[model samples]
Target: MLSTGGSALIAKKLGEGKEREAREDFSFLTLVSFLFGIAILLIGNIFIEPIVRALGSTDALLPYCVDYLSVSLLLAPAAMLQMMFQTFFVTAGKPLIGLMLTISGGVANMILDYLFMGPFNMGISGAALATGIGELIPAVIGLFYFLFTRHSLYLTKPVVRFQVLKESCFNGSSEMVTNLSTAVVTYLFNITMLKFLGEPGVAAITIVLYGQFLFNALYMGFSMGVAPVISYNHGSQNLPLLKRIFKICIGFISISSILITIMALVSSPVIVEIFTPIGSATYDIAKTGFFLFSINYIFAGINIYSSSMFTAFSDGKVSALISFVRTFVLIVLNILLLPYLIGVNGVWLAVPAAEFMTLFLSVYLFYKKRDVYHYL
Candidate 1:
C-alpha cells in the first residue's frame, strides 16, 4: 500500500512539474515505511508463537515455524524497503536497475540456500537466514541509491504530513486488501481440502497454488510495470496517450492470459511430477485439480489489471472494492458453497468460479469509468 500509493502520488506530482513536492512525498513515505517495518519486526517477534498458531500451524509444525520466523522477522525492515523501492524505481525511471537488483538478490539467495542447508546442515533456519540476507541486498542498495545518489526521485528531509499518509494508505488499500485476503483464502482452501481429502489434498492444493503464483506473477508484474505510466498520463490529462496505454495493456493482458493458460495446461503433468512422484495419490489429485485451476488464468489477468489500474489512477475506493469482491467475498462464498454443492470438484473449481464472475464486475467498472478516466 505504501509503495504503490506513494509512487502514484509522486508520478502525479512529477507530471504536474512539481519535483520538490514529489521528493517530499517520497521521503515522507520512506520514513513511514521504515517505521512500519520496525513495528512489524518488534511485534512479530514478540507474538511469533501465537501468530503461527493462529495461522493453523500444527504441533509438529511449531518448531519449524519458530526457527524460520525467528530469523525471518529480522528482515522486516529490509523487506519493507525492498518493496517500496521496487515501485519507486519505476517512478524514477530506474526500473531496470530495480529488476537487476532483485535478480541478483534471488540468485544470491539460491546459492546461500544450498550452502547453508546442504553444507552447513542448518536446515530451516538456514533457509530463513538466506532469504533475509537476499532481501537485505536490494534493500540496502535501494537505501543507498535514494539516500546518496542524485536521482529524479530521492529522499529528502521528511516533513510529517498526515494528509499525505492518509491518501497513500487509501490509494494503496487494494494492495493491502489483496495480500490480507490471499492469506485468509489460502487458509480456507487448506481447511476445505483437509476436510475433503486429508493431507494429500492439502499437498495437492499447495502444489496447484504454487503453479498459480508462478503464472500470475507475470500479470502482477505487468500491471505494476505500467502503473506509473497510467498515473503520469492521467495526471497530465493526456487522454490520447492514456487511451493508447490502456489499449496496449488490455491487448497485452489478453494475449498473455491465453498463452499462460495454455502453458499451464500443457505443463500440468510436469509440474505435478516435480512436486510429487507420478502415479502417487497426491500427484493424481494435484494433476486433476491443476487442470481445472488453470482455467482461472483466462479471467484472472483482467481482474488483476482492473484493480491495479484503478489504484494507479488513484481511485483507491473502486480499486479496493474490486479487490475485496474478487479475492474475498466471492472466493469465500464459492469455496464454502461449491464443495457442498458438487463434492470434491467444487473445491477445485472455486477459484475459477470466483475469477470468472469477477470479470463481469471488472468489465462493468471499465465501462462505467470510461468517461471519467478517458482510458476506454
Candidate 2:
C-alpha cells in the first residue's frame, strides 16, 4: 500500500512540478509507514503464539515458528520501510541505487544464513535474525539517504493532510488486498493439501509454491518498476507517451508470459529434484503438479499488470476490485470447489483456473478505462 500509493502520488506531484509537495507526500508516507510497522511489531509479538497455532502448526513445528517470528517481528518497521523505499527510489530516478542496495541485502542474507546455520549453529532463530537484518540494511540506508541527502525526494516537515492519507490508502488498497489474500490462500492450500495427501502432500505443495514465488516475482517486479512512469505520464497528460507505454507493457507481458511458461515447464523436474530425491512420493507429486500449476503464468502476467496499471492511474476502486477478485475471491472459490470436484489434480488446477478467469476481467477493465486514463 505504501509503495503503490506513495509512488503514484509522488510521481504525479513531480510531473506537476510540485517538488515541495512531492517531498511532503514522501515524508508523510514515511512517517505513516513507520507507525504502521511499529503497530505490526507490537501486535504480532503480543499474538505470536495464537497466530502460529491458528495457522495449524503442529507441536513439533511450534517452537521453530515461535523462534523465528519472535525475532522477525522485531524488524517489522525495517521491512515496511524497505518495501516503501523500493518504489520511491524508482520515483526519485534512483532505481539503480535501490536495485544495488536490494542485491547487497540479498547477498548479506545468504552469507549470514550460511554463517548462522553452519558455523554458529543458531538454528531457526539465527535464520530469522539474519533475514531481519537483511531487511534492515536497505531500510536504514534508504532512510539515511532521504533524511540526510539532497535529492529529487527527501524528508521534509510532514503536513498532516487527512485527504492525502485517505487518497493514499484508498488508492493503494489493492496492494494491501493482494498481500492479505496471499496469506489466506497459502493457509487454505496448506489445509487442503494436508487433508488429501498428508505431510507429503503438504511438502509437495510447498515445493510448487516456492517455484510460484520465484516465477511470479518477475511480473511483480516489472509492474512495480514501471508504475511510476505510468503515474507521471498520466499526471502530465502525456497521452501519447501513456499509449506507447501501455502497448510496450502489454507486449512485454505477453512475450514474458510465454517464455516463463516454457521455462517453468522445462525446469519442473529439476526444481522438484532440488527439494526432494527422484522417485520419492513428495517428488513425484510436486513434479506432476508443477506442470499443471505453471499454466497460471500464461494468464497471471496480464492480470498482475492490469491491476498495477489501474493503481498507477489512481483508480483505486478498479484496482482493488481486480486484486480482490483475482487473488482472493476466485482463488478461494476454486481452492475449495476444485479439490473436492477432481481430487488432487484439482488442487493443481485451482490457480490456473482463477488466473484464466481473471484475465477476462483484466482485459475488460483495460478496455473500459482506456479513454478515462487516456492510455488507449
Candidate 3:
C-alpha cells in the first residue's frame, strides 16, 4: 500500500501534459495495482490452510479465513484506487471531487450489492465483488475525466520515471500509514478477541467496528475536504487562518465524536443489529461489542485531527508516526495486555486506549512545535 496513492503524486509531478498523461499513467498504474492485489488474494488463498495450521487455529476457522480473503479479491482494486484518488484529491485540495466520486461509488456499491448479493444469491462473495468493482469504477472514470478535460493542475508530463514513482510513494505514505495501521489494528482486535472469548468475541468486535466506520466514512470525507485547504494555506504561509480552520474542524469533530460516543453507548445493540440478524449468538456478541467499543470515536477523532496537521504540512514522517501510535501501538498493546487482565472484554477498550495515548502525544507535539505552525 506504500504505492497505493501514487496516482495523485504522479499527477502533481507532471511538468506539462497534466491530465492526458496523468490519465494514461494512472490507467496503467491503477491496472497494475489492481492486478497485484487480485494476485495476492488468489495466491494468498492457496496458503490459507497452511498459515492457519501454523497458527494452530481450528479447522472450523480456516474455511472462514479462506472465504473472507477470496471474497476480498473483488475489493482490492477498488479499495486501492479509492486510496489513490483520496490522496490525489485531498493533497491537491479538491476533496469535493473525491467526495462526489465516493458518494457515487457508494450508491453504486449498494445497487450492486442488491443485484449481485441479494437477487443473484452470490452471498458474501457477491457482496465483496460488487464492492470491489464499485471502488475502482469511479477512479477510472474520474481519472479519465480529469485528464481529458483542461484543469489548473493538468498532468504536464506523465512520464513514469523512477523519480516520479519514488516521490509518489513518499507523498502517499501519510494516507497509507493510516490505512495499513487500520488493517493491523483490526487483526489485533481479532487475535485478542479469540484469545479472550473465542469466535463469538471476534464476531462481536468486528460488527461494532463496522458500525463505527459508517460515520467515519463521513469523517474521512471531512478530513479529505480539509487537507488541501490546510496544505495550500500553509504553503502560502497562512498561519492565523490555519489555526482558525484547524480549530473549526477540530471543534466539529469534537462535537460529532461526543454525539457519536453517546449514541454508541445508547444504541449499540441497534447498531449491531443492522449488520447481524437477531436471535443469534453472533448478534448478541456483536451488540455487546458495540456497547463496549462505540465511544472510540472521541479518541480516534482527536488522532485523525492531529495527523491532518502533519499531512497539511506535507510532513509524512510526523503523520506516519502519529498514525502508528494511535493504531499499531495503542491497539496492539491494549489487546495484548487487557485480555490477560480481564479477558476478551479488554479488546473493546483497545481503540479508546490507543486514541487517548495518541491524544496526549498530539498535545505534547502541539506545545513543542508551537512556533512551527503557519496561520491561514
How many clashing residue pairs, candidate 2? 0
What lDDT does the true structure give each of the candidates? 0.92, 0.92, 0.67
User: lDDT by residue for model 1 over 189-279, one digit each (tens)?
Assistant: 8888878998788889999999999999999989998999999988899999999999999999999999999999999999999889998
> Per-residue lDDT for 145-226 in model 3, tens only?
5566555443334445565445545655766777777777777777667766688777777787788677576566677666
How close is every model to the real structure, measured as TM-score? 0.97, 0.97, 0.83
lDDT of 2 by residue, 79-128 (tens): 99999888899999899989988888888998998899889999999999
Flag clash pairs in model 2: none
Q: How far is candidate 3 from the true structure (C-alpha RMSD, Å)?
A: 3.8
| lDDT of prediction 1 | 0.92
Weakest 10 consecutive residues of candidate 1 by summed lDDT: 53-62
Give the runs in model 1 whose Cα sits over 4 Å from its true position: none
Number of backbone-clashing residue pairs for each candidate, in the order shown = 0, 0, 21
